[model samples]
Target: MSHLVSNAATDKISPTLPLTTDQKRLVDQILAFTTAHVNETGPAVFTVYGDAGTGKSVILAHLFNQLQTASRTRPDSPLAKTTNYFLVNHPEILKVYREIAGKEPHLLKKDFQRPTSLINQLAKGITTADVLVIDEAHLLLSQPDHYNNFYGENQLSSLLAAAKVIILVFDETQVLRMKSFWTEKRLEHLLAHYPHQHVRLTHQFRMQASDELVAWINDFTHSQVRPLPQSVGAQYDLRIFNDAEQMRRAIVTKNNQVGLSRVVSTSGYPSTLDGGKHYITEGHFHLPWDQYNYTSTPWAELPQTIDEVGSIYTCQGFDLNYVGLILGPPLTLSPQNQLEVHLDRYTDVEAFKRRADITDAQELTAIKKQLILNSVNVLMKRGVKGLYIYAHDAHLRQYLGAKAH
Candidate 1:
């Protein structure tokens, strides 16, 4: 198979194409809604929700580029008349946009200390933009405090007051990140309060039909109360090699069959076991500069250092054809022999404590269970054909048992 080259170099990072059949229908609906609203005298807000890695960002990028192009050529066109604004939480998105736009736009630095200033700054930008697209809207509404801080005195009101069209892209399922305020109820409240045209992106194009990981995630999120079959399950094909040598050999073999342009997800750091070096496949890895620090280098320069043992928060909006998750020390079983799960991603301590099994809840133990479940969900969903598990802990193996198959 031939690899398609992207117009922009950044597209090589994780390039994806347009939506599939079902997704196209949904996109058409969204476009129709936007067109209708653009024609109206009043402002309008459009919301799009979907599962993680379901092409929300891709769609947003496509829309941005298309609108920008249309505006450039047909200055009188409805889309052309609209000034586009893309709001995102990740700095990476800004970097990608900068690369795409080939220039820097006016930057409004956020002031975290003086919360009111942040809202004011965000509100101030709306007047210049005819259309505003806020990606990862889930994060904006996940926290009450941040919600108040960002939207205090009706910040959305201010934005709507200025912009002719406001589009929000959110995924309730991907609300695992820290400082996120995503929830089904919160989204509903937003729609009700704001009176926006809401649409859901449900057709998953990232994972293939053979991926069982999707079913696991659905079950896990909806509570393990539902019956899920492996036939229609969303899972990945995972393989465990004895060491890095075997992993390297496997990756080389796969890439040879496919192409050199393939990518693999791995932890961003190196691990030394005894005297041997264990390197993760592809992508750069980085050792933490400081144990308490939360920064790392990009995966390209040090592909071996990319930490695959990331939380659900870090893994959002990313998809892997094949995920090789390394189980670190933090995810090992304790002396008590219980599955201690961590809920630190959750802001509500009481809710976390209540859900966690306190009987054997050591830091490592809790981390282990959470990692296992999360890794199982993440790693399994990553592959279209299979899933691989390399559990250093024997107890975890026993727990996974037949399910690992």
Candidate 2:
């Protein structure tokens, strides 16, 4: 509950303490480049790309620690004084970092802000920090509309203009909205005019599962038609249950046994708590999503949230010991024997809002489907020890059970 007093508080961001080999290599490279950039006034750009559990944030934290140490050793180092870190997406994630840092729970207000906030500051000539380190860069909006978007322009250019040394931690698959469509091609094109380095971190560090299990998870969520490898089946605790109550009970048991276990589901089911309905119900199983005002603690960390479900917005960019995932109404099996997504079933107004005018229904449908699939991918991969699934559609459940088993 203590607040960190300084932005350079590395201890708070040290959750997955030891960096994997891939992460360490990237951090070392960034540290060396940052040192040179500071001494010579050289402009530099670098991107660290990875999937959900690939330690992108971990590498950024390590880089921050290394830079902080260098600044301490060289008291006159400009990089130490000029560098700034920003977590653009997930306030809960910012809280987790603060908790890890163990000091700056209060100072996070200054340390963490949305990408748009940084742009607004730059436009107003608020601060002159040169090095900008961005976590959850995929959430950066290309065309800002709502969410307090003061710049009303592309965030990419605004960020680049704000800092000489640009370090972005990105995961392309986590792009949840249409306005936030930042792609590799666009990234490459932008950096082509500047000196930039692109590096990949592929090591699986968060999920305490094997490489095979990770691959299987990736394939399953993306709707890739691949048989679940027997080795992965044996090593990872993946289960498909037809009954949602059974899955919920198992998840509760898992939480009591090991902690850090919670239930998460798609927003396909409507949240009726505001309408005097305490729980979301289907057949005999029902649970409520975390209260909209549940802001004191991160959803996955709190013991009470185990009774409330989490969605992609609540669980992304964080890891858990176990996850009970419910595949809601949006996802189903088509007559062609393929995975189909129903956009109407999804009730996340912000996610499906037409930020840009698109007249074509087909185009809108395709985009919505991709967003749903991405959400499913994120929710399913939150577990470190195991994943328990309950598919709402009977056919999809049968299909998943057959393939996963």
Model 1 regions lying over 4 Å from their true place: 1-18, 39-43, 100-127, 141-162, 209-211, 220-236, 240-315, 327-340, 343-387, 391-393, 402-405
Model 2 lDDT on a 0 to 1 scale: 0.70
Every candidate's CA RMSD: 8.3, 4.9
Over 198-244, each residue of candidate 1 has an lDDT whose tens digit, in order, gives 76766556565433446555665343522334455333344554443
Cα error, residue 102 of model 2, in Å, equals 3.9
Model 1 gets an lDDT of 0.46
Lowest-sum lDDT 10-residue window in model 2: 1-10
Q: Highest lDDT: which candidate?
A: 2
TM-scores, one per candidate: 0.63, 0.87
